[model samples]
Target: MKRLMKTTIAFILMLMLTVLPACTMSDSAKDLNSSAKNEVGKSGESITLRLTLWGAPNEISVYKKVIANFEAKNPNVKVELQSIPTDYDTKLTTMVAGNDEPDVAMMESGSIALPLAEEGKFLNLQTFLEKDPDLSLDSLVPNITYSSEVGNIIGIAPGPESYALFYNEDAFKDAGLTAPPSKVSEAWTWEEFVEVAKQLTLDNKGRNAADPEFDPKNIKQYGVNIGTFWGAYSNFIYSNGGDFISADGKTFALNQPEAVEALQKLADLVNVHHVAPSPVQAKNIPATNVALQTRKVAMVVDGQWNSSSLADTNTNFNVGVLPVMKEPVSTVVCGMFSIFKSTEHPEESWELVKALIDPEGSIDMLTYGTWMPSLKTWYTEDELVSKWTDNLKSRPSGYKDAVIDVMLNNSHQTPTGYVKNFNKIMDVVTPALDKVWLGQQTAQEAMDAIADKAQAQVKGRRDLE
Candidate 1:
């Protein structure tokens, strides 16, 4: 009996020792696994982020190269690039409505960015900028940076985009002119510009605007090709001391006398002066390529992106760039990349954005001539300016100065509210403006109709407040 009790006690003690040690080992393993997962979550050690943008084939190629380089340097984070089509706003709207928003997206200036920012779809970048002192806000051009501040900076301007006049040097010489004005500060007033354009306009018999036989009906070439796009038209309107919307953002001011005068002048170019292509003719050309390449028009106002198109073609004419309206006033279209509030990795998304707008990246874009650098310091520095001018052996005389003026002065933005509903209202205004251009309706009648309809739509939107 004594032997039996002793055996039982020994067995119980042995079992307790074995089980306790095994249970401790199991607990330790679980702790190690939990710690590793926490570290991964904190560091974003192995994660993929989605970036969305719209670009042409070459533009996408360039972006891909930049992304590859970024990925190599950032081993723990990977980026999947999704190339959205040019109709990005439509695509984005659908995606957002479906609750499948991209982690990051490139937004257009004026209407697209303002409305999206108001919807609270984008992450507030002010918080990130505040945390990173190395990301200098001062480096960006003041106006460009100011445009990005939708209720305090929802994004950063990734590229410096601006509008300038593109002129055909051969056409100028054909008109017996010395050269198109290059400096915006020294640019000709509207009257002076019209006079030069009139000289460039020719009839089949080679008669000029001053000649009585220079028949508008039998014209061989237009002196200018003013874009009929809403954004382009706004440049003219704003430069003439007119505005589409009031400063308070509540009312449409486009029916004012100044605004009417600006519209009349634009119409006169087609109807009275017979120097610019009619809106119908401009639309039929599809892109500006035919007008510029064939030298059918002497001058046209276009954005920096047109540089690539000009370079890609075999046209031998020297290209010159100037600011808007030949007046000191101009408007700039500044676009940026915004991270959505639903982004899974806000920190990583910002890092990618920083890489894209870094000084080195800015230099690459500037060298391409499709974009101006957004950095203020780079604009003043001789080295940066020389990159575009000194190397361009084909550049027309005074071309560099004109581009520089566009960079320095005459860069402004439409009021925030105007930008918010840009496309919606443009749809209304374009057809009405077209009617005026087609002679179906007078400028006053067309503008009055546009003002009434636009005001109603805008008022309804504001009432949602």
Candidate 2:
């Protein structure tokens, strides 16, 4: 009887041990969930922060590294990256309207930044910058910084970018030209540039620009490839003393005499001079492919990002960089990061921002040859300038000087203002401008119509404000 009683007690204890563990586990799980809910204010601590940006494959890889580094440093913060193929503005607009905006977004330097800032969606960074002494706003390039600042700095410039002319050296040599212009100050004037372009242009018969039988229709090569995008057009307009919009952002100035003259000059390249491809012809050929691979055009104005793309191509031709117009005027576009007011951990977010844009990190971007550092000090530093020369050995004689001149003296912002619908205005203007390029309407006729429509849209935006 004693043995049986002992066996029964042993069995009961074993059963209790097994059951007790499960009960304890259930309670522990409940406690964990409760703690997480409390910490995250009913949402949960595993909040997924989203960031939206657009870049090439390599840029995506670098961004992923940055995010991974940020995540490893921040164990509690989980970030989700979102990439848009194209039409970033549309994606951003849709997400913002749905109240499903990413925690951070990358935007361009033109009217996009200004309009978004006016919408009050972006958090003002001025307060944060003033409070944080470690983040030296002075370190940034003045022109780029100025462009990124919307009203009172809703964004911080992280990358500085400028446009330069890319020319095919072999093409110039074949045309028997001495050398391409090197300095922005010495950059070929419109008339002089046209002359060089004419000489470089070729037809199937090997007849040069001097040959009367040089076939415009059967031409095998174009003199220049002017990017037809709005940003590209802005350079021509600005150089010709035209403004896209008035200072108030309420009136459209694109239809002014200067603006019309600029558009006419671009049109003349195709219709009158017959040295460039028609709008229809240009549309058929991809801009990058035309400039880099086919070498169909002798010169093209593109940004630093093109270097990476061209380097990956099979083309053996060396590219020479040129400044904007002869007057040495160009626009600088930049990308920036902003911290939102709704962030649960402002301090941590700011730390991430600083890590991503610090001098060392900025130099990493510049080393890739895809971007220019926003920090002004990097321009002259032996380490930074060396990279430019090392990678672009065959750069045109005056290319470096022109880049320095633009960086130091002549860069300008695209005019951000209180009008919230500035991009919408661009949407309308680009298509109308395309009509002029297509020869459907004259430059003045197209600009006049577009100005009337844009002015009404701008007025509506003003009324909303």
Number of the predicted model whose lDDT against the real structure is largest: 1
- TM-score of every model versus the real structure: 0.83, 0.78
**Model 2 local distance difference test score:** 0.65
lDDT of 2 by residue, 381-452 (tens): 777666554555333244456555576566655433223455777777888887777777888998888777
- Report the C-alpha lDDT of model 1 over 1-465, residue by residue, as the tens digit: 447645755565456557667656456556555665575656646778888888767667767877887888787888899898768888878888899888877877554666777777888877777788667666666555533334367667766666667777778766678676676656777887788889988878888776778988776777877767655666778777777766556666667777777877888888888888786566554355557678677777776666656766665445444434434655666667788889888988888888776656555555665666666766688876676556552334555666656666666663432344656666677788887777677767887877877776553222122
Go through the candidates in order and give the C-alpha RMSD of each one to the true structure. Answer: 9.0, 10.9
Give the Cα error of residue 83 in candidate 1, in Å: 1.1
Q: Could you say which candidate leads in TM-score?
A: 1
